[model samples]
Target: MKNLLVTQYQDFVRWLTRRLGSSDLAQDALQETFLRLEQGSSIGPVHNPKAYLLRIALNMASNRRAADNRRLATSEVDKLLDLPDDAPDPARAVEAKSEISALKRALAELPARRREIFLASWIENLPHPEIARRYQISIRTVQIELKLALEYCDSRLNRRNKLRG
Candidate 1:
């Protein structure tokens, strides 16, 4: 099984890419299929190895497509854009700006390390592992710093909100 996959990997990827319309998704499916084959239990005699591998890859692609479809439709964003504008009123806009300024101040008050970690994780959408690797700290430390930073900012914002109320 492994030998067949290795020999025909490119062909499989190309076939899947054409069917799936995404080379990246094709690569992912093939990689997953290979991993599964490695850990797969003993297989009985196969009549056609290439057919078997293609079936597995196709099944994986189908499953991935179904899972992705369940998450969100590609047209959802377009539908949102077609919606009527619901612009904020002057008072609401002013209030929102004030809240944003307060949040900025709260963020600025955080320790440099904590602030950087928070921004990297949320604003930059970085994975915790990458952030930890960059900071030369454990993932756990990254999580802790993020948690503390969030708590501090939330408290500051909540306090400000209460004052306005």
Candidate 2:
């Protein structure tokens, strides 16, 4: 049973890693998946071990990505806090800062779930079926979210560009 699980999961991890576009993250997610399996954690079943593992991996990756984004946002805020109140050319700096703020605001305005689907599909390059499975939704839903996200991003960018012009 152990050997079979190892072989099956290892192959699935390899495939998932490729799908996820990050070998290091894949390794981490794969290990977590197996740990959950070994502990008898109720994450579906072993009938389609590959699909189950992929789902686990996708969830883990999404979580890690969110944590990373939070850290980055925190750091950016800290940097802004450290800026000198009496800096030279404050107006120019303020304008530049406003642009960054606008972009961040635009991203934050997107629906959380749609943002996740967008990032996973475009940034992570995960396939629709795999993302759908990971989120326990249909592929059609993934397609719809991705479409909405793209439209949102496009419009936001266009507006920002117009403002700059």
Candidate with the greatest lDDT versus the true structure: 1
For candidate 2, which ten residues in a row score worst on lDDT? 156-165
Q: Write the per-residue lDDT of candidate 2 for residues 96-139, one digit (tens) a residue.
A: 79767766676688999888888798679999999999899999
Best by TM-score: 1
Q: Candidate 1 lDDT, tens digit per residue, 25-89?
A: 99888887898898978889999999998888888888988898887566897897899968998
Model 1 local distance difference test score:
0.88
Local accuracy by lDDT, each model: 0.88, 0.75
What is the TM-score of candidate 1? 0.45
- Candidate 1 segments whose C-alpha is farther than 4 A from its true place: 1-84, 159-165
Pairs in clash, predicted candidate 1: none
